[model samples]
Target chain A: MPKEKAITAEMLTKRFGDFIAVNAISFEVDKGEIFGFLGANGAGKTTAMRMFCGLSLPSSGKATVAGLDIYKDNEAIKQRIGYMSQKFSLYEDLTVKENIRFYGGIYGKSDTYIKKETEILLHQLELEAQANTLVGALPLGWKQKLAFSVAIFHQPDIVFLDEPTGGVDPVTRREFWNMIYEAAAKGITVFVTTHYLDEAEYCDRVSIMVDGVIAALDTPAALKKQYHASGMDEVFQQLARGAKRQDN
Target chain B: MKQFLSFVKKEFLHILRDKRTLFILLGMPIVQIIIFGFALTNEVKNEGIAVLDLAKDQSSGELIRQMDASRYFELRAYLQNEQQIEKTFLKGQIKLAVVIPPGFDHQLRHTNKAQLQLIADASDPNLANTMVNYAGSIVQQFQSTIFPQQQAAYQIQTELRMLYNPQLKGAYNFVPGVMAMVLLLVCTMMTAITIVKEKESGTMEIMLVSPLVPFSITLAKAVPYLLLSIVNIISILLLSVYVLDVPIRGSVLLLIGMSILFTMVSLSLGLLISARSSSQQTAMFISLVGMFLPTVMFSGFMFPIENMPKPLQVISNIVPAKWYYIIVKSVMIKGVGFNAIWKEALILAGMCTFFLAMAIRNFKIRLA
Candidate 1:
């Protein structure tokens, strides 16, 4: 049986003035799958994600998120999806508990639900002692973890993580991946974009965008075998080098 | 609405945590008010004068004595001749010199009209004009005293009643103007900077991706500043009424309602600035050079708009603070109600609507 589409795009494009940021791209993310969006710096990954999240409108083409029209039902779609940006998006001035409460409240969660979830979240992260401390005073690793947790605090159907673990220790990055896995276990679709080829291997399926176009999309193992590469890293390098050769 | 409340609560926490910002919000207004009230003034006193009495007669001597007795002029020295007048002024010791021509008493008694040459330093034109006026008033008083029977010809009777501030107290004028200025600075500039900070931090993108609508996000950001500005207005009113003895002769509720309206206008202006600026520094610059300068300069705080150049006076109409200042003065000083200040109030409300509409449109364009 074919996978159920959680997100769909058909020739979606975004342009700023005369410059095209995200060229025509078409893809779909299945429900409850970890979909990795891989791209080099300035390959238009962020722009595409922004369009998918309904923060930016496509210059042309049609897209739907969670079965709702992107343009007409953006608000409804936003309520059903979580988003974490490359920068840790939590308010640095607010405490951990306060941040959770704020995000939860914004998602229209009840006060009691927020209070209960706050306790559970703090306990799970082992950050109960630092609950009242400001987020700015926390370490970067902890901030990244807390930001991921806050993004999914409302238990949305899909969580969009835009380069979620950019700067962290290897151990912390592994631990953050465990959290992502735990969310996926609860049947939450994880739409992630990252530069780490090793991290792409952990995704159920991955898509590589090169020069505003998806050059490759498949399971990491399948992609490596098809490209005759040793690992995901070699596969990505081979695809990028092939694009450069074609341009020449 | 729940999302907006949470966003507003977060904004309050941000403001509370930033100690420097809090100090600027609460401290700058009071400091500005005190400085303007005490240190800045248009009134002049104790100007230095030199006497050049070429006619060494009793009447000239009496006039010199009268000039010395008056508090407005301080007798610096007696000049030797007309040539010394320039030297004395160049030294900067005296601002004016009285040159009594030869045979001054003889001419006054014979012709009943005497000419007194009053030369003044005109480097600072305002001070020069004031000094000249003071000297003329003193001479007229002396002439009246010397020839009371000739008052029919030299009759110059005038009654001066300084309305609102009988003593022309600086606080009476500055308190309300400071209220207008501080409210504008805190409400508009601070809101713009905070919103721009969010954009710089990349948190605004995250928030935008959430379920919150653009209107909800902007309205949330505006709420905290609106509340804080109202509190600031209260503090300013209390300070003016209690500390400066500047009474609010009109209804307090009306004053507060007008303040809130003005604050909305200022906040919308800030939102407009934030929508255009991509960075915090750019927002700060726009607020300081664009909003702050006009609020202080043309809001009847430093320079009276009526006394300004006609073009500048016309330009002040665009500044929201100008209308707020007039409304405040009418309510606080003139003891007028909405019936008298309705036009200014209406202008402020219209400006608020226009700014808010522009901000909403800009937000939509940015999203697109």
Candidate 2:
């Protein structure tokens, strides 16, 4: 039997006045898969992620995010899918514990559950001593890790992370991936966007978007072999060099 | 409800930690009240006057005495000539000059018609107007004493009483304006900045992605600001009543009710600005230059609407602060009940509904 799908998009498209951001692109995310959406700047990877997270309305096409229609009841979809943006979405002025508690509370987590889970998460990061410190004082790696934790605090059916690990040191990026892997292991579907092509190797499946169209969709091995490239970086470079779109 | 509480709590933390916003939140109302109370005034007290009394008779002496004790004038000198009167006025030692002809007593006793010329410096128009009125009233009082039962021709005995502001303290006039201004600053500028700051930081997207509806999200963001603005209202009222001696002449309940309505108007204005702006800098610019400039210029704060030109007066009707200023003045200064101010109160409520609907509509489009 085929695996359960968490998100389904058919010809999903978005336009800004005359500029088409996300062209008609169709894809499916499995229930427990770590799907990587790869693209260069303004390739419309973020736009697709926005549609899945119900942040923007699709100019055309249909999508079911976390098994709910994006158009008909996106609010219902919002409750089942967590989201983290390119910028650090947590309030920097709030303490580490405060940021966690606030996100947890707003997501309808029981107070007792938040208390228990917060303690466990703080211990796992060895941040028990700094729980009361504002997130702004934390180093880039710690803040990223904490941000990812907050994004999944609700334990939604799926979590969409748009450029979750940008501008971090190599070691921290690897550690952030480890956390992502850990989350995926718990049966939570992870749909993430990143420009770091090397990170694409870790996804169960990868899709390359060029000018609002998904040019390729397959496992890393299949995509690399089809493109006759040694790695995802080479495939991305070849596809991006052929694209006719550019935006910041 | 729990989610809203947490959202509000986080909003409070954001506001309390931001030093610049915290200063504006707590510091502006007190400073505005104190500044308006002491520095800006229209009352002319102890203004110097010179009388060129040629008669030096009983009637002129009594007229000078009455003017001297009226608390509005200080008798500077008894001028001798037309040159001395001009010199006294030019030197700025006296704001008013009274000229009594030599036949003043003879004319008043025999002809029953006397001409007393009053010359007031017109450089400062408001002061000059007040001084002229004060001197004219005193002359009328002097005439009344002379002709207690004679009923002089063309003499209309006028008994004037200034209602509400019995002493005509300028502070009474501004207390309501200050209240309106403080609420506008706290609600419009401050709320718009905080909301746009969330959008700039991208935290608003995170919250939107949560289960909370956009309406609750905006409302939750506003709850803390609403509470802070209320605190500002109380502080301003206390400062106005106790420190400045400005009385809340009407029912305190009506005054508080109007304050809440005005604050809601300000909050909706802020929501409208926040919906239009995407960055804190843009929101601050729009909120400051957009909301406040009109509020101060046309809200009847210092410039009375009745005296403003027709177009400006029409524009003033659109400013919610203008209505609130009128309502507050009527309730706090005029000592009027709800019946007298229901029209202004209705307009403010309608504005609150319109802006709120616009904000919600804009938010829907953004989400879409």
Candidate 3:
């Protein structure tokens, strides 16, 4: 079976009254592809991500995610997609098992699926003993690992992870990418945002957002060769600096 | 509905898991009720008094017995001299001193009148005034008994009819306002903090991205606090009626209904505060500085609204607790039905709706 497009946006824009936070931007992602979204602070990457994730409506744009309208079928889009923010937004007071059941139930997954999937997940992650413990007691690495597992537990078509591996040790970051690779191998589209340029090398395709517009979107190696930059970090600095000095 | 129930259950777990907050939530009202009920009454009891009876006669001794019989005065010492009386007052041992001049039975028989002096430590003006009036009334009674032939027509007697609270219990004044203050603190502070907590921890973002409608999210946040505030009202009612001897003169159902309406107003106001604040500390600060003080000061809880400056009296009209205090007093103390308190009740319900609408607007604006 031929794979289809998972995400498509055309001239998507978001404005905050006097500020055009996300100027007209557009992009597309193929199914089962791991797409890296790179941007500097205040580059409007978050605003565009919010528009795609249905957290905010577009000021003017046309977009579809998981084959559903971003404007009319926002609720439907929520069920087909998963989002994990940088803050690791899990209930610290709730036990690990409770958080799993809570997210599963919210996604409208069946009870039998939740039970069967929860057991498999606990065993696969080697967290059976800690399943009943509050997530607050877990170390940062373990919490992030658990959060990622829960975020993808419902088998979403596309999972939007906004800087998911932020603030973790290098070894843990490597292991977290292994999990992302594993999810992609299952034919789930991985749409991620990250500032760690070295991690950008792991993406199948990279889109660098500068000043609310996509300055570059292609394979990292192709972009590196095109810009004559030996590393993804240099490539990012070149694009980021261009926008800062644009109007000046 | 399932989503809302799960959300409410999660909130309850948060409430029950934190032992310190649980202690505060359950402990504060009971402690406040006890403090206001037993410790802060206006009626004087077991106050100390000293007597300086220079006359070694039957009439002087009769006056002393009259004072000792009343519940208000406890005779502390029979002073040997005026110096002894002043020293006793300085020690804080007695609030009042009654002096009988040396001519007691002889002067009463010869002149048909005896001069008596009453000395009071007026440090606490209210207590001192009440004690002196108590002593003066007892002396006047003694004089009347000793001389029946003298009923002066020119002597004006002040007939004080304490209407609702005949004994003038301060608990009568405080219990209703405590309801206002407690519900305001519990519903407003708790709901505000709970909502801001989700925002601060970044969980609100995830919830917003999920399938739950904003309305359901709001209702879910409000449900647990609503139930808890209702429990608060009942506990306060139990404490006031059984423990404090405060009567619920009107229908029990009506009091509960008014309480529920007032709590909704408090909860929506809390939601409004939560929508404005981004952190728990800011929400708590607004709840305390904004809602708590106004409820205490302008609601006529501690001071009567009639006595406040005209400007403050006008400001008091905007405080939801001001109307709630009136309803509590009317339905609980005055025992009047809904007909009498319908206007206050309607105003409170209107405040609830107005706050709810404003909170929804604020919340949606922040989300967008």
Candidate 4:
């Protein structure tokens, strides 16, 4: 019961001019669970994530991450959550080890802690050989994995991966999910947004957003059964098609 | 503070690894100093003159000899008639024409008065005025020599000594101005473009999301350039001292401190520009077009602000470089201390505070 909620949202809405990007969407994410935020492009997944990450203000709603107010305690929330942008957000000119040290330094980690964590992370990814090479020279899969590791290097309460595995081979994607599963197993909450429906099966709960509104929010199995579908893809297609029908 | 240092270290790495930025930051100051020191001199030399000696006498001959010996004029031809004078001048072959009348020697002996005509090509009015003035002075010197008693009766004696730069070398004026310009270009333009590049590359978002405050991020971007600008100042001073022979007569520490202060003002201006500009090209264009000409023209670099129109003189008062130039001229050229330059220093410090506040306010608004 104590771990039943990691995030709470009540009628969270964000608008730009007359256009509403997130329209009264609300959901809860449990602790130590992988929550999948699935949406087509322009469905406001990034905007909602930005609000949840305390990057932008919600127009007329309330949200809390790690029990901190999004408005008054944004700095506190920022210290407790980690974010890895869709755009590979590591210093391309810095080495993998240096990037880790830089992030750890900003988080006020001791130099000894940084050195130990850097060795462990590099050894875990088997990228110890590239410790001195610039991150820009690394392969895309390695960069994504390294960026994710750096994002959560300080072991925040929750890690927000905004499409962390966008452009990678299936094998690399599988490896990336393994890293995510390991982190989740360690009692860290994972909030991820992705276009890959098959990856939804890996999540403890999934939400399908269509036109700035959540059409379904439940466990992947429950969502499939509720939509009378066999998998997450059919549930998404049904929800999207239903939304399009409602729009016309 | 530790976080700020690490961020600044990363910025230095970015500047060092990028060859183009490195070249612009380090190479431009020395190159600009050399160009402004040697190539852009205002000294007029070896101007061509055509002499029409109708007297064909010793006095006229002696006047022509003195003109040739003075090195200010090279007698290109001797004109026989007024028609020839017009032809030579129209052909662009002569910049000045000296016409001595037939009765020149008789008039000097009897009436103690001689007449000479100096006609200069006015197409290039500045050079023409300089050439005509030199020619008239040479004639007056000859008249004084031949009739020292007569000169004592009707002569006006004057002694003029040019201070700071005895020869009135243009390099002495331009060296400090070029330092101001080069520092502005390197500190403001480079910082603006580099910060905009971070935004464009999406790296700024990453830095912003981290625990580093926005002010620390901006400070990190500025400190490296501040150090580099100081290095440039030293290089310019060394070049001026050894190569151009322009003296740094005041306390070196004061000159350096003023340079660093000006560099900070420029860096903050760049920050303000970068905060408003979303793209590197826009940032670069804003710094170059917005800051360059004003620093060069209105800062008393090319034209003296005292002689400028009243409106422009008032406008120049607002330019921080104008105050910096005054501070530098007072310190490096005039050998004055803080007492002599406290007013200009106060103006520069006020400008620095204004720019720093504006940049901080702009940054906050941007984040909001």
Best by DockQ: 1
The residue-by-residue lDDT of candidate 3 on A163-237, one tens digit each, is: 998899999999999999999999899999998999999999999988878999999999999999999999999
TM-score of each: 0.89, 0.90, 0.92, 0.93
Candidate 4 lDDT, A1-248, residue by residue in tens: 32367888889999889888889998888889899999888788888888877667889888888887788877787788888988877889888888888888787788888989899999999998999999999999999999999988998989999998898999999999999999999888999999899999999999989989998899999888888999889998887874532321
> lDDT for every model?
0.87, 0.88, 0.88, 0.86
User: Where does candidate 3 chain A have its weakest 10-residue lDDT segment?
Assistant: A239-248
Q: Candidate 1 at residue B52, lDDT?
A: 94
Would you list the clashing residue pairs of candidate 3? B249-B335
Q: In candidate 4, what fraction of native interface contacts survive?
A: 0.36
User: Rank order by DockQ, top first?
Assistant: 1, 2, 3, 4
Per-residue lDDT of B287 in model 3 = 99
Higher-lDDT candidate of 3 and 4: 3
Q: Which runs of model 1 end up more than 4 angstroms from their true locations?
A: A1-3, A15-24, A244-248, B49-88, B97-117, B142-156, B166-176, B238-247, B300-313, B365-368
Model 3 error, position B34 (Å):
1.3
In order, the first chain's TM-score in every candidate is 0.95, 0.97, 0.95, 0.96
Better of 1 and 4 by DockQ: 1
Q: Which stretches of candidate 2 lie over 4 Å from their true place?
A: A1-3, B48-70, B75-94, B97-117, B139-156, B308-312, B365-368
Question: Measured by TM-score, how close is model 3 to the native structure?
Answer: 0.92
**Fraction of true contacts kept, per model?**
0.83, 0.86, 0.55, 0.36
For candidate 3, write residues B1-368 as lDDT tens digits. 66666677778888888889888887888989998887877778878989999997998888898898888899999999878988998899988888999988899989877898988888788788988887888887888898878867798877879888887788889999899999999999999998999988988888887777787778788988888888889999999989988999899999999999999999999999998888899999999999999999999988899999999999999999999999999999899999999999999999999999999888852256
| 2 against 3, candidate with superior DockQ | 2
For model 2, report the TM-score of its A chain: 0.97
